[model samples]
Every structure is written in structure tokens, then in C-alpha cells.
Target: MREKIRSGGNAGRVFVLVAVCCAAAAMPLTFTGPAVALPSIGRTLGGSPLALNWVTNAFMLTFGSTLMAAGALADTYGRKRMFLGGLAAFGLFSLGLAFASDIVWFDILRALQGVGAAAAFSGAMASLAQEFEEGERLRAFSVVGASFGVGLAFGPIASGLVVEAFGWPAIFLLVVALAALALVLGAVFLRETRDPNAAGLDWKGAATFTLALAFLTYGILQMPDVGWTDPFVLAVLVAAVVFFFAFYRIERSVARPMLDLSLFRYPRFVGVQLLAAAPAYGFVVLLILLPVRFIGIEGMSEIAGGRMMIALSAPLLVLPIAAGLLTRWFAPAVICGTGLLLSAAGLAWLSQFPVGSQPELLVWPLLLVGIGISLPWGLMDGLAVSVVPKERAGMATGIFSTTRVAGEGVALAVVTALLSAFTQMNLGPAAGEHAAGAAQRLGTGNVAAAGSMVPSMARAAMLQAYNDAFSALLWLLSAITAATAVVVFLYLGKSADVIDGAAGEPGPLRTTVMDP
Candidate 1:
């Protein structure tokens, strides 16, 4: 009976699994394309710094805010139900983008699309957890991770081709089609799964967290346009701080909180979450800033710009599989920390290369980053879920995924602000103000506008400004990665002979070198 109950290898089940992977890969379809299309989108909508950024930020903000709530709902109701519903809503929202005549409507539609993605992301993770057994589950997730890498590797090229052929809105239209197919296939093939013992929804905690995320993101996004001291930005920042504190308090007080406040007490769990979120932050800056240098500043085609991304995403496919096997020998701390060190090394090396340098020059470093991110990708998630009780898989998955996407949002805004501020600092105040606006546009990957805005200054100055921005971003991420590596090392210091003395078990690391 147990074997029969656990069996999920039917044709429908297999198809549904693949479909879910495809859907997850497709979710980020719009994330990269917008980097290429933002200039065009801005042309149609008017290129204020805020308008340009909101195109991406709108989706990220809503997606980050709603992910945990969606995960909690999946546990309470049905993973399959929420998964399918998310697909439907996301598809509808994507379709709506085709008719967006103004930037306001575009932002609104993008935000709604994020809501759909949150449901899809959390539900798919929980649904997969429900379907697979121990060893097989790892394989399933690896395939899913590979699918995402494939999508990212191809995204810039695909979006470039589509945007160049049609227009910017066509990108959303294409996503709508992809979402619709996933929706139909999922509805037919996937079965419902939910926690029978769920304590129920925690609306107050949800509201508090959501407000905190929104306000914080808003403040970060505004920092580029309005310096950090603007009264409105300060007020919003204070509110965000208050909401975060309130969220922690509410979760602690509530009988059924959306987030598990106790989970943070686990050093392993928090370390894993940071590991998961850190790469996302690094990747966003890479994706947004690097491509703009290629397409916008260097005058390359979108296809060429996207192809440049391949060097970064391709290693993701092979290294993760190797990393899985490596878990047997290396402690999670050693392996994950090494990955971070390598990633930081790569960024630091790449930061020194001149702007418009050959892609060949960039490939080795990019590959290192790809390898680095892959190392702890699946390993961290496995560790995170293991620390929690089995029935709360949905909650665990949601928390992990939320941290990943939310970190991407905050980092994107931070990188944008930092890039713009640094450019102004180097360029001088009177002319720097104009250069600052151009620098802001470049952060969105709008090379043409940035180039056009240079006040009769040589293009060399703009290129230098861009190089300075890129160097700042690289240095910042490198510092963060190096710091994270130290922390992760301390937390997961034990990896040998910790799991029932089993040779290859994947759980909490407890083999401290100091004890020996």
C-alpha cells in the first residue's frame, strides 16, 4: 500500500513534473528580457528613472511579498489548486500587458503577474515535495534547477530576438502563451496535495510582512532619484523598520503565524537561507548591468548581449550535479564556503577588466561564478527543509523561495542606487547631475539614452563612468560573498560523521574540526 501510494511515475505525473519545471523556468522569462526592452519600453512610456525601473521592480516587489502567503495557503488548501490557479492568474496578467498603453498600466499588470508567479512558485515547490520520495526527490529538483538554468541561458537571446522582431509588449505576449499551456497541462495532470494538520492562515503576520517589504523596496528604489535624506524616503524607511519589527512581534504572538519565528533560531536554517539569497542578489546585478554594457554602451545587438550571458549560466548545468555528489565528501560549510570564495574571486577579477573587453576575456570568470552559485544551490535547500518538521514542507519551501526572490529585488534596487551615486561622485556636481540621470538610465540597461545624455563630454567619460559603476557593484557583491562565506563556515562547520554515521546522508552539518 505504501509503495503504491508513493508511486508518482505515471505518464501524467511525469508530464506534470516536467510542466512545472518549464513553468518555473518561464517565470523569469520576463525578468531578463526587460533589461533589453526597458529602453524601448521607456521610449514608448517616457523615460523617467522611476518609470524605467518600475517595469522590473513592480514584478519583483509583488512576487516577493506574496510568495510566503501563497505557500501557507498551499499547505492549508491544496498545492495543486493554488499551483493551477497561479498559472491562470499569471497568464491573464501577462496577456493584459499586451494592451498596456501607459506605464501605469504596465506597472499594474506586472505587479499582478508577480502575484500569479508567487502562487506558482510556492505551489510548485510544495507539490514536488509531496510527490517524490527521499533520493528521487533530489533528482527531481536537480532537473528542475537545470531547466531554470537552460531558461536563463537562453532568455536574453530569446527576448532579444522577440523584442527586435516585434516590440516590447510582444515579450509579455509570448510569456502569456507559455503560462497558458502550463496552466492547461497542470490542471489536467497534477493531483491536489495539502497538509491535513495545518493550523490555518495568519493574516496579521502576512499583512505586517507585506507592508515591511513594500516600504523597504519603495525606499530603496527612491534612493537613486531622491538622495537618501529626502524626507519622504526617510519616512518610508522608518515605516518599513516599524513594520518589520511589528511582523516579528506579530509572528511571535500569533497562534498561527505565516512565518515560523522559531526557525531563525536555527543557525543552520538561517545560514542556508543567506546562501540561497546571496547568489540571487549577485546574479541580478550581473544580468542587469553586464548586458546594458554590451547592448546599450558598446552598441551590440540584443542577441549578442544575451549570448554574452551564456558564459555565466552554462556552468550552472554541470556543477550542480557534481556538487550533489560532493556532499558525500565535503562538509556543507567547506563546499558552500569554497563556492562563495570562488564567486567572490570571479567578481573581483572581472571588475578589473576594461569596459568593452572581449567576451572571451570575461568567459573564465563568468564560468567560475556559474560554478560557485551551483555548488550550494540544491544543498542548502535540502538542509533548510531537513531542519523543519516534515509536514511543514510548504512553509519551509515558501520561506526559502521568498528569501531568494526578495533578496533579488532589494539587491537590484541597491545596485541601481549605488551605481548612480558612484557615477555622480566621480563626474562632479554641476555636470554630474546630468550624468547622474544618465547613470540611472544605464542601470536599467538603457545604453542609448545614457549615451545621448552625455553633455558634449567624450563617450570615453560615459564608458569610464560605466566601468566605475560596474566595479562598484562587483566590489560590493564580492564583499558580501566573502562575509557570507565566513558566516556559513562557522555555522555548518560539522559535516563528517554527523548523520547516524551514514557515509552520504544530507542533513544538518555537525562535524566541528575544533572538537577533533
Candidate 2:
């Protein structure tokens, strides 16, 4: 009877792992799928560039901002409850997204969908911590990470095929189905868990942080359309600064803050945060930007674009696992820093090719980027908690995850604005008064629409202008990534010590219950 019970317990844990992994896979699928379908969404919905951007931006904004708060809520309220509720909300929102007719409704639903994603992801992660321990826990998280990789690896191709066949709505339908399966499994297998010492939700901090990011993203996304000096843009940009200050104040004053501001005092902790954000500018933005460049700007078929994206993302499926294995021989800092430098090289190499370069010309650089980013990606989660004291592991994890996701949203907005600015400058004499308008369209990957707005003779010039702008953007990204690599390397070097007052010792990974 005892043996049978032990075997059943193992079986139950396996089911729980499957449930959480399903939820993990769905999140990235939602994130990457829309990028592949952005052109289709724009065509069907007929929204402006700003509105179209909100399709991806809205989801990222809420998801990233809500993560910390969601993690806290799960800790206090019960992980299983939050997980199931979040899954249900995610499924409902995805359903609404599938049927959304107007771009406005679609954007609203996408934002709400992000909230659900945050809640579900935080809750699922917390529950996993409770379900597994020590070596088993590491294995479980590895499997979860692999599940996420599978989604990122195939999301573009899957979305492209779906969009080609059944339209953009089908992508959301797929998410809905996945959410449903996860919900059912979680309902059956998940056990409720909570932090007994958890404090009240930091409403002020959450509000201020959310507002700061929202204002900043809005101002940046709108700057290209309405000049930077436009009163409304300036006003929102100022508001962003003020709210960020307010968020800083709130977190410091709160007894149990969503983010422990003190963590920044530790160089290694700060380094980990920076490392988390590096991929946003270097790699994540490309997930969206490249799809648009291929299908919308270069006029490649959706299937072809998706296939090309595979070269950029497929390395993730194996490189992350390989990174973990390499840790036995090399320090995580050396591995991660070397990886970013490699990615910088890839970016610089890719810049030599024009926007419409053939897949053969682009594959190697794209593959290099995938291989480079994966090393750091695999190790970041482990590094986040390891750098801090065991007691603060949960907060460290939450803050690191928040930085990563939020940074992606911010990077996408900034890169989009920069691309438009570059394109406008390149189109100077040829486009004349229509330069700004054409630049906006081209920046958003609406090449067909942008061409129609300009003279037939100037269209060739416009395409060439876009290519130049893209090349300039890649070089800028490369430089920033390389600089970041240097900083991360120095701060996380052997001289760095754990925040727990340890001296001259690299932080070791411990079995702590992470809340996020």
C-alpha cells in the first residue's frame, strides 16, 4: 500500500508539471504569434500605425507591469486559486480576442489578456516551486524552460501557417485551446500553496509602476506620428518620469515592497537585472521586427517568412540546455558575457545585408544571434536568485522577470520610433512632405500601403531608404549590446560577492521557494 501511494504521488507531480508547462508554452506562443500576424491584423482591421503597434504593445504592457503584483497576490491568496483563475481569464480573453472586430476592442482584449498571463505565469511558477525540491526542482524548471523554448522556436511558423489558412483569429483560437487544457489539468493536479508570511499587496507601487511604463511607452510610440515636441507627447513623457519617481518612493517606504529597492545596492543584483534586459534590445525586438521585414516589407509569403524566422529562433531549443551543462566548467558570467558579445557580432554582420536580402544571405547571422542569446537566456533565472540571499529569492525573481518583459516593451517602442526617424532622414529629398507619413508606415512594416502614399518613381527610393534605416538600427543595437556585455561581465566577475554578506565567493544556486 505504501509503495503504491508513493508511485501515485510521483504520477500526480508529473501531471502538475505538464499543466504548468502547458501554461508556460502558451505565454510565449501568444507573444510571438502576433508578431507574425501583424500584417494580417493591420490589413483586416485597418488601424493606424499606433493602433497596430498596440496589438503587441498592449499585451506586453499589462503582462510585464502586472507580474510583480500578480506574484504577490498568488503568495497571499493561494497559488492554485490564482493559477486556475488566471487560466480561465486567459481563455476568456483569448476567446474575446478571436471575435474582436475593431482594432480598439482587439487592443483592449489584448491588454486584459496580458493581465491574465502575468497572473497565470506567476502562480504557475510558484506552484512548481512547491511541487518539486532540490535536484528534482531544477529538472522541473528545466523542462518548463524547454517548453517555453518550444513555443518561441515554433511560434512564428505555427502562426504564419494559421494566418495563411484560417486568418489571424486562428492564432488566438490556438491559445484558447491550450489554456483550456492547462486549466483542466491544473484543476485536477495542482495543490493550493501560499506564503504564510506574505504581506499585503503594494497597491501604490503597482499603480505607479504601471502608470510610469504606460506613459513612457505611449509617448515613445506616438512620437514619430506627432513630433517629439508635440505638447501631448511631451506631457506624457514628463508624466512617465514623475510616476517613475513616485514608484521609487512607494517601494522604498512600503514595509513589504513589491520590489526591494535595496537590491540595487548589490552590484551583482544590478548586473543580473541588466543581463535580463539585454536580450530585449538585442534579440526579442527582432522576433517582431524581422517578421514584418520579411513578409510585409520584402513581400515574402507568410510561410517563407516563418521558415526564415526558424533560423533565428531554432537554436534556442538546444543552446539553453547546452549553456546549463557548460556551467560545470565555466562561470555563468563568462558564459553569459561571451554570449552577448557573440550576439553583437551577429548583429553587426547582419547589418551588412539589406532589408530584402535572400534567406541564404541572412541565415548564418540569424542563427548566430539565436545561439548567442540562448546562453544567457538559460542562465538568467538561476542567476537572479543566486545573487541574493535565500530569504529574498522570491523578490529577486519577480524583479528580474519584470525587468525582462517590461524592457522588451520599452525596447520595441524605442526601436520603432528610431526606425521611423532614420527612414524619414533617408527619404529627405525624394519623399518631401510625405516623408514622415511614409516612414511611419515603413517602420511598421506596411510597405504596400507606404508605397501607395508616395509617387511611383519614388517608391524604389523609399524601399532603399528603409533598407538604410534598418541597417543603421542594427548597428546601433550591436553597439549597445556589446557595451552591455562588458558591464555585465565586470559586475558579475569572480570578485563579486553574494548579497548575503559573503566575501569573495560566487553565489551558489540554492533550493529556495521562488514566488514568481
- Please report the candidate that would top lDDT against the real structure: 2
lDDT of 1 at 461: 74
Give the winner by TM-score: 2
Q: In candidate 2, what are the lDDT values of residues 344-436, reduced to their tens digit?
A: 999999999996677899999999988899999999998888787766777889999999999999999999899999998998876777778
How would you encode candidate 1's per-residue C-alpha lDDT over 326-382 as one tens digit per residue? 978987778888988888888888888878788788888887887777787757767
Candidate 2, TM-score vs. the true structure? 0.95
Per-candidate TM equals 0.91, 0.95
Prediction 1 global C-alpha lDDT? 0.76
RMSD of 2: 3.0
Give candidate 1 regions above 4 Å deviation.
1-9, 388-394, 430-435, 447-456, 494-516
Alpha-carbon runs more than 4 Å astray in model 2: 1-7, 494-516
Give the distance in Å from residue 251's predicted Cα in candidate 2 to where it truly belongs.
Answer: 1.3
Error of 1 at 120 (Å): 1.2
